[model samples]
Target: MKIVEERISQHFQLYTNFSMNSPIRLYVRFVFVHDGMNGIISSDKRRRVVNALAKAFSSRFVFNHIDLNDQGLYCPDYFRLLKDSEEERYIKAKTQRDPNVYLHIYSADTFDGAKYRNWSSFPWGLEDDPVMDGVVVDYRNIENEESYHWIIHEVGHWFGLVHTFENGCNPPGDYVDDTEAHSDEIRGCPPEGIHNACPEEKRAPINNYMNYTDCKDTFTLGQIERIFRVAKVYRPKLLEPEVCIPPCPPPM
Candidate 1:
């Protein structure tokens, strides 16, 4: 964990003008730590899922993907301390003395009838940043969806996106212009452009990942803008250059 933080911080510190309003640029490092007791969906299968999800980022953000090793006997050594009490510990722990590269523990489970909940089963993503670092996805959420949409949804949160309908005033919603001001979460499919017109007079983006309303899987232009904005402000390291290769998602 310390090694990851150090590497991220070192790369991010190189930039002098970082703030809450910077442009979105992301450098992603995926570290998969499978629970020994759990079964992993094969590598090839995981790769397909990741690639499909990466497609959503092409239009609005710039990012580089790096797959961390999956050699640990069980899960990564750092994940052993993943108890609820250790909330936000990643922010303070410096891997290699840097503090930018973030780590998320990927888990798979057979949640018989459970539904997809928060990234860490709570509203807050991480203790330190509130939108960075945490575990995501279980078997029940993406069991049959080959699209890897669930993974993308959680990663989207790691990249800084809130649930579509947060509160009555829409203040709790992810402050993006085009998204409808949703007063409640959409659980099932909504109309193609079901706009709640909350904060402003506009159609709701039913397809967006942030929206709670269940609908066709899609992202609105406004949602993309918000993602870009959040990435710019927080993970500038993702903006760093990468090898010029075809746009394939990161390897697992």
Candidate 2:
């Protein structure tokens, strides 16, 4: 999209300083909300999600400032929370928060009022609204490997990736040079050589994070580059050190 390309030219625009080969290290704060009676998302699940992110961003990002929050039993009204203004709620909603966290993520009992298992800060590339930023996921999906990529996919959007079938592969589509054009989304794990509307371009990389495909695991070079560009333009804080990981205590 034009939004992504225009961002490439914006201020905080260190498009040149970026080492072409090195990964951009970023810090993440994971805040978990639950009934005090229930356990937080297990370490196993957390580790899996972390690992998936590492692989997906291997060439572009490194995550750190890994931390957790135990906000017991705050009921989030997912439907209105998403459709209406989210700022009234989550902007003041962080608990056990770390000011240094660059990527603030959460795990709750449900998301989108259970209509959708997960939700994330899309269009964050459009502006800076801390409360409205970051990702929120259902507790159970965080534990399921099959579903966990939902978080990674959402994060991709946060950094400015459009769907693989973005705008039907129209000009400036997905704004990535390496990914193929697709007319629509891939609903689930598609078999190799599945139908592609843009046969003129090679088959779509259906497994890309921007797609709705179930087996997704890749981010094109263009996407990684765009992510870095967008971060500088819209989320420059990610490059700064607000807080480093452990040995640091949760905010009181």
Candidate 3:
């Protein structure tokens, strides 16, 4: 991990204005390698998942697919795969042209119903601007057709959106002007600001992809626009691609 940090620091230094942009689009590629016991997810499923993300952000970024699962572990090819994927490549690429690309590593693991706890969870997904340059998600808890929903929520974090509730009322609140300034963290949908009942003005966005769920779902346009703004400021390299069509922008 020291090597990875060294590489990222070196790149970050080169692009000093990374945080200045209000909406920086970032480009990223994913590499799924078999680790151990519970490992990487399926290629086909991941492809569809990535596609959904691309659509969600629309003009905000680009996600390139460079399949490398056929490669072996511990080999030069494996090491090369790490550097070749969007995490390293995007960082290196961004440093060369601009200062807004961030590389993040994603992987599957046991959630234990808590935030990531160790080096294994070091680059845990962010609620706002969730996906930096890369992120790994474990589908173990997500079963059957629900895998898509899981990926969407985790990826939502990659785009910079935060959980509607977690810990306590924090600063910078979930950037969306409409989301209430929450005071606590919640898992299964709690009633509005009320942990147990519905408030007259607000209720938990139980249907929101950001909240924990037992159902399949969709993201609100307001949520999409917020993430798009975050991407433009934090991930400019991703926006470089020339996309002919933009997915329907989420409502604000």
Best by lDDT: 2
Task: Sort every candidate by TM-score, greatest first.
Answer: 2, 1, 3
**What would the per-residue lDDT of candidate 2 be over residues 1-252, giving only the tens digit for each residue?**
455466566643545567435445566666666554442666556767877787777745667645444343344443223322453255335443432245666666554654665666654433544555667666766767888678888778767677878778576566777888888878788785646747668577777888888888888877887777766656665555343555654443
| Model 1, position 249: C-alpha lDDT score | 48
Please give, for residues 164-241, the per-residue lDDT of candidate 1 as tens digits.
Answer: 665545453555556567666656665655445565646666777766544436766666654544344454454444
Please estimate how well model 3 matches the true structure, expressed as its whole-model Cα lDDT.
Answer: 0.44
Which is the better candidate, 2 or 3, if ranked by lDDT?
Answer: 2
Comparison by lDDT, 1 against 3, better one: 1
**lDDT by candidate, in order shown:** 0.47, 0.64, 0.44
lDDT score, candidate 1? 0.47
Candidate 2: where are CA atoms >4 Å away?
1-4, 10-18, 36-39, 70-88, 96-101, 111-115, 122-128, 240-252
lDDT of each residue in 80-105, candidate 3, tens digit only: 22322454344333322112343233
TM-scores, all candidates, are: 0.61, 0.78, 0.54
